[model samples]
Target: MPPGHVADRLAALVAERESQIVLGLDPDPARLWPDAGGDPDPAVAVLAHCRAVIDAVAPAVVAVKPQVACFERLGAPGWAALAATVEHARAQGLFVLADGKRGDIDVTATAYAHGFFDAGGLNADALTVNPYMGLDTLRSFAAVARPAGGGLFALVRTSNPGAADLMDEPLARGGTVWERVAELVAELGDEHRGPESGLADVGAVLGATQPEHLARARELLPHAIFLLPGVGAQGGRVEDLAPAFAPGRAAGLVTASRSIVRAHEQSGGAPAAAARAEAERLRETAWALG
Candidate 1:
């Protein structure tokens, strides 16, 4: 399917679900599938763990954001597993957000666009991209994304502590660099607005870890959806992300991966069962907030 078609479907899913929770699939090798046995192929174990987690949480969330690095580290097998995960998510009626954070010159950016958005490739409904190269770079990728109906979540304010170094720097024209990124998110998103949801195709990733930024980000991109990461294991509070939904409760998407997947450790139960319980818990909490 084309990318724009995917975005439309995702918008409908978000509205129908009345919940914008996008569970992240950032699998940490050591922590995930520890019981898969130290075989020659750890990637297989990771794939199994990822698929199990997806099955456990698919009913509670609208989308899944897979951190590409986790797969990349495992080489070819990892990429294969990543592809399988994407297919699995789609089969379950969930959108897949390829969280690669790729950005570069126009030519390379276009390739990255193809790598994620192309029909024959991974076939993701949306992908997270880095916009540091400039508006033109994003514009290049957006050209491909807009037509396909795929969405891109530009990184604005990340959850990591080191983000303050660059994102917090004051700019001559206005607020911080992160604020400028928000402005770009709005401007670039002008073309992809969904008529029903009043949300633009271009979105922003505002870490749930930094709830305060939500207020500012919302002001900048009122019509854009905010992909809120850093929740659960990252210490992002659900209550703090309320501003992301000022336009509507569906405006903010709460994402969690490790917190739910590793929940078995605390529950002292089967991994799949514990994971499902954690996902349901997060779903209930996020819905209540919505």
Candidate 2:
């Protein structure tokens, strides 16, 4: 799975699915579904919730991004549920991204890559990566992701307000730390290009909640894909995502998590029904904006 091979698979999947959003599955035990047993095993409850959300939203989105911490906390049982959920998503023709944000040097990074991108994996189609470790640390992950036709969304400017403490700090080399991260995204994407749109395989995670950074990030990584998180409950407006689509409709992926999955709480309707409606609403709004 070289860069070209994986890029092709991703592009084709997105095209066929007619979606760019990757719904994140981050189940919190304290917020278990209403029907969940009082003494319900946290892992079992999470697995059920994930499946319900996937079943509800799969038709509207192309992929699902599961946060590893949510599952890791449940230990082996949690991992098993994660693998099962991933299999279900694929069975429904949806791509999966393990949102672990894993990063380290050499072999450590390489092993992490194998865990997420390998064929025998829980069958993830991509994973979020932390580029703070330097471009070299990403080599092993890239090696697996590129060839398998999987992908990585390197963190650049996260949505959390506290990110300014570091990500927005000025660097001695010039510009801010995030600017350097943007440069790295552009550099890694220098090779792979989309067959039709000319976009690249490498991408950056630029939170949609921080619209101000979108324009600059797009400029820096002109050819790289952009994964825009923080929409819906996070206060990111779909209308503010213009810069992300500058490269074209397929350029940026608008991801939402709790907002879509927990819509039932707001609507006072059946969880599955509410979740489906919410995902469709976001999909419609985002598609129009893009």
Candidate 3:
């Protein structure tokens, strides 16, 4: 890997932390930590909840995936909160993957990239992008991310049931839409492959809910890191995701939102303590796969 490539940085962090969990921060204003609700402003409450969650789980995870919509709904205050959340995660030594799933063409794509990768913006370590518009859209994101030592995780086969509507469609050319998308991800990622880690700056969002597709996805994206979501609350098991770690421990990042944050609801304990325990459990399980 290049000295300062994003993939190299990610791999280094994974080894240092001895974990591959990516804490998903999809904060719902109506459902924050009990103490956070004391704040009148929803955005402030959300930020407090995020900080508490990070503080609890930072030691067990290598990164945080912040769902942008969760913060965007509150307008300016929410955006400010999102920025603060990213900064706080960084302060805790966790990578920030801004989950906007943004897609566009030309200058618009460049603008979105800037919002996530440039100075004074979120300055995320990576961003989730929608590749439905085609590879050019990804190119725009890479154009910005590469220079900033950032990365991009393109939505290949998402965890949502609705994804089957488009992603699973049999192409007339004799492959599935997602299979074709995987090919594109491989094609683009090859250009920026990390030498030491054998990972690419460009990666794939392969939902962990569908383990059957993982072997096939890995076949197509050998060098791309897989952001495997859907564990715990979404019913994805860590054992089924072993294929994603074939390249190395950092090759797959298991992201869990409600599974860790709302653990108190199921385990019945203090929110932070429950969340910390859940995150540690997930970290241990995923680390074993490597």
* Best candidate according to lDDT: 3
lDDT to native, each model: 0.82, 0.82, 0.93
lDDT tens digits, residue span 150-226, model 3: 89999999998899999999999988999999999999999998777879999999999999999999999999999
lDDT of prediction 3: 0.93
Score candidate 2 by TM-score against the native: 0.94
Alpha-carbon deviation at 116 in model 1, angstroms: 0.4
Which portions of model 2 miss their true places by more than 4 Å? 1-4, 35-39
lDDT for model 1? 0.82
Residue 88 in candidate 2 has what lDDT?
85
Residue-wise lDDT of candidate 2 within 157-271, one digit each (tens)? 9988888999999988889999998898788877666676687767889888899999888889898778888998889988799888887666788889988888889998888
Q: What are the per-model C-alpha RMSD values against the true structure?
A: 1.8, 2.1, 1.5
* TM, every model: 0.94, 0.94, 0.98
| Candidate 3 error regions (>4 Å) | 1-3
Q: Residues 170-202, candidate 1, lDDT per residue (tens digit)?
A: 999879999998898899897667776777888
